[model samples]
Target: MDLQLPRGMRDFPPEEKILRDEVIAILKNLFELYGFSPLETPVVERWEALSAKYSGGEEILKETFKLTDQGGRQLGLRYDLTVPLARFVGMNPTIKRPFKRYQIGTVYRDGPIKKGRTREFYQCDADIVGSSSPLADAECVQLALDVFERFKIDVVVKINNRKVLYELVRAAQIPEKFTEAAILSLDKLDKIGPDEVIREMVERGIERTSAERFLSGAQDPQAFKNSEGYRELEPVLSALRDSRVVWTPSLARGLSYYTGTIYEVYAKDSSVTGSLAAGGRYDNMIGQFLGGTEKIPAVGISFGLEPILEVLKEQRRDLPLRKTVTQVYVIPFKTLVAEGRAVCQRLRRAGIKTDIDFSAKGISDGLKYANAYAIPFVVIVGPDEVAQGKVKLRDMRSGEEQLLTVEEVARQVAQRLS
Candidate 1:
């Protein structure tokens, strides 16, 4: 049988993995800089825990992959990190209020596989729990902007509030029961276009004229400052006034948990479509985990690592690939293998990344291997060099060779790399 990876899965080779790691590191650093502590949650969650009620809404629930363990316990791979976070907050009341945390991990979904969408992907999430302040929401937006800015990627953050969406729906005379459905349909405005979205709203039991009116209101942010949604969103806009954030009333995030501000991020110019990151306020989700009576104000944003990577790749904005972690390659002549090991050990002890080639290949082959991996330095230890207690250090890039003591070689290479 031929070996093949499952559909919608991916194998990240060394270069790709390095880029992914770099992105995650940047996100983690920014999250920490913004006062968010690191957190982790299990990949597998109880099916009951991730049902439609708590885990966003029916849309996400439908995409969740369900399974049964040997003990007959029903479980599902987590579709998103936010649900697990809510569960954690609900179960751990002892944790200090207004808990702020960031999580970076892989999540699974059984949805259709596409360009930026996959069955398994990484999500970097930062959340503030227990704070109703719009500043918290603004902070999330700022963090998102900071991440993209670091990448040198131009992006626009579209901000909206669920309460504002509700007002628009009410103005359209769309019944309250169809609000969720209407928002879900509106979320696809960019993809399906206005005509299709209006048809969807009509199908969802909203009047055609009302649907058009609601969508028109979404296009005009200034028309609804006195409305509840805009009133709630005003502080957030004020806090992020210096940012590239815009009031996008049509951006009703698909999640059912968002009770207030919702946002979606997009690359300003790129072939990669869809949001790079998105999140919003979910004031009632944690309370639902506790009992649905208590209201715990919470807001967060999750960076879609996969889609960001897609954009980066399309734009060719990637870090230089280091095929090997070894910064120095030690190549020994036939009988000087022992000396090579000693030199490698000395360099490593000095906190330098060093490797000794055990292949016993000639100098030509050794240089070939080092060059292939883009290793910057190659050390040649032969009888003459060993007797002199020195090694020939060759700068792979410049082809410059010099005889130096082991310590000198280590120091020089470290300095050059640094």
Candidate 2:
């Protein structure tokens, strides 16, 4: 008998799960700080809705894991959050305009797996609905920048305009009918060399001359300054001019719905193979769901929780990655479990993460247990300390000990933690 997860999926153990949670906590806080409220959508979405025009463009559909329910209705796990967001807004209709929302949840992709790509992962997305202003795009940029800064990861924020890319395709003599395919191929420009990109474009039916010409111009943002996309993207870059953002002309976010600016984030000098976060201004997806009478403009950014955890885990090795959230471990001396239980409750009441060894163990063995679980502080409870209304608090890291009253123990631990 074989017990295993499907390909490209993984079960995160405590240490890994703790790191993932840390990333989520930071992103959730940052998302709300910028006026984006929280939103939740079902993990399984209708086949119709998932395949609708509002969904993540054609490329992602290749990875959609389709399923048939017992009732014979078709369903697919959500591949991304932005599509669900569009669907939710489309159905509600009266959701106030310029709705700012953020969602952090599981997303599935049955695509090829790589160093940073996974089949089942988490996306933390923040978006604005009913607005076409580049300021909204700019706001996403600043928010994304803040996110990386908080993580202490050095990254380059890359910006591009889909409109500008379209013009470059036109200028390169690529047929209008093959524009989407051209953009998809161009998206690999940074991954594959220009020669391979041209080869891929040609293989996809683009003329070699046109692919070559487009590849050359796409690398230079100044090549399309006369296009409206360049103008539309100007305000955003201007707003973030001092932020050291790069005008990445060829950033084809690989999504057909990206009607305007596209954003991608990459860690600087890191081995991660893909963008840590990305998004764009998608102005038409929701309208398609709403029957096209009204325009619902939107922009968003999504942070990949897995890739971030990977980066943090690699870059922040000095950070204590603990299996448990417990800050203090209580070891009862001999048959002193009851007294230790009292101390545990007192620490828990003070909002301290406390865990008590219900089975009494020797002081030396208890310290080993606490250290093994990555617990930082250990309280030794014995008959003497119990009678004296005090405990021996030992710092696992420094092995420093202090004999203090329970009140003093809580105060000192809380202060050091803060």
Candidate 3:
């Protein structure tokens, strides 16, 4: 029998896992620095919670991986973190208002896999709920910019509003029934190009001249001030004037729930084909969960972890790599295994990442192993050193050796690594 892994999934080995963890750590630290607290939700959610109305739209719903439990309960893996966050806020209303939270987790979607698209991927999200101020939206944009800046990735943030799209559709005289279809077609402008998008819209029963006019109007920011969407976006634009942001009317985000401002991030020079991150304000989703007419204003941005890593790799950025957790490798002569263990314990107690070779291999083989793992230091515990209550510490990088007490070795390594 041949064993195989599923398509569009991956196994992150040690080196890749370390790089991934480092990315997560950097994002977490930045999120915390921006006063966002961390929160987590279960991977599996009830089917109803992820249906079209709450999730995004019919397109996203179709891509959700639906399943049934042994008890015949319908469930689905969360396609995105925003829907779960809305459900969480609704279930726990006593939580503080204006809640700020960040979540990093894997989300699954059953969709056509491509270079940057996959069935399972990690999303790092930061959101602010219960804030109606456009500052919340601006902050989300700034946070995304900061993340890319930290990685030294040049990016251009495209901003738009759903209300603007609606007005543009109205301006185009696209019939009410075909509005969603037209918007979806427009959303593909980046991928399919203007000509194809116009062709698609024309095929969808929209007038060619009207579609052309609408596309032209969208490119000019001055043409949108009459729109309520323009009014909503004015403050956000003001807030982000110092950043690399542009009003991209063509960015529809392909989400039905985005009631207000929306954003998408693109790498300026990257081999990856899609946005690095995207999100928007969904003012009514939380209200749907509460069964109330009152809206709970919410805004968020999610980083596409896999695509960001791909871009970084393509750019040849240096990523952290350590084959083992051991900062120091302790090798003992055949007779000094007990002493090696004791030394290892002391080093560990002192917060040093220490490992000992239990194979009782020759010193040459042990040194080879240490070098293979790129361990910085190696401690040799042999008969003479044990008798003197000392150990020989070899600096792997420098090939220098020194005889010192175990405590002295620990102190020196700790200070040097620190």
Q: What TM-score fits each model?
A: 0.95, 0.97, 0.94
lDDT (tens digit, per residue) of candidate 1 on 17-50: 8788888888889999999999999999999889
Q: State the displacement of the C-alpha of residue 385, model 1, in Å, after optimal TM-score superposition.
A: 2.0
lDDT of 3 at 312: 79
Q: lDDT of candidate 3 vs native? A: 0.90
Q: Higher lDDT: candidate 2 or 3?
A: 3
Error of 1 at 34 (Å): 1.4
Q: Give the runs in model 2 whose Cα sits over 4 Å from its true position.
A: 318-320
Task: Give the Cα error of residue 62 in candidate 1, in Å.
Answer: 1.4
What is candidate 2's lDDT per residue for 1-418, written digit by digit as tens? 7999899999988887877888888898999899899999999999898888757768888999999999999999999999899899999999888899999999999998888788999999999998888899999989988999999999898898899888999899999998999999889888887888888999999989998899889988677888898899899988888454788888898878889989999998787968999999998999998999888999999999878877887897787777888899999887888889999999989889999887675988888899899898999998888788899999998989998887788998999889
C-alpha root-mean-square deviation, each candidate: 1.7, 1.4, 1.9
Q: What is the lDDT of residue 10 in candidate 3?
A: 85
TM-score of 3: 0.94
Per-residue lDDT tens digits for candidate 3, residues 205-305, read 88899888777776677888778998899999999895689888778998788889999999986779799999999999999998875679999999999
Each candidate: what lDDT? 0.90, 0.89, 0.90
For model 3, the superposed segments whose C-alpha errors exceed 4 Å read 317-320
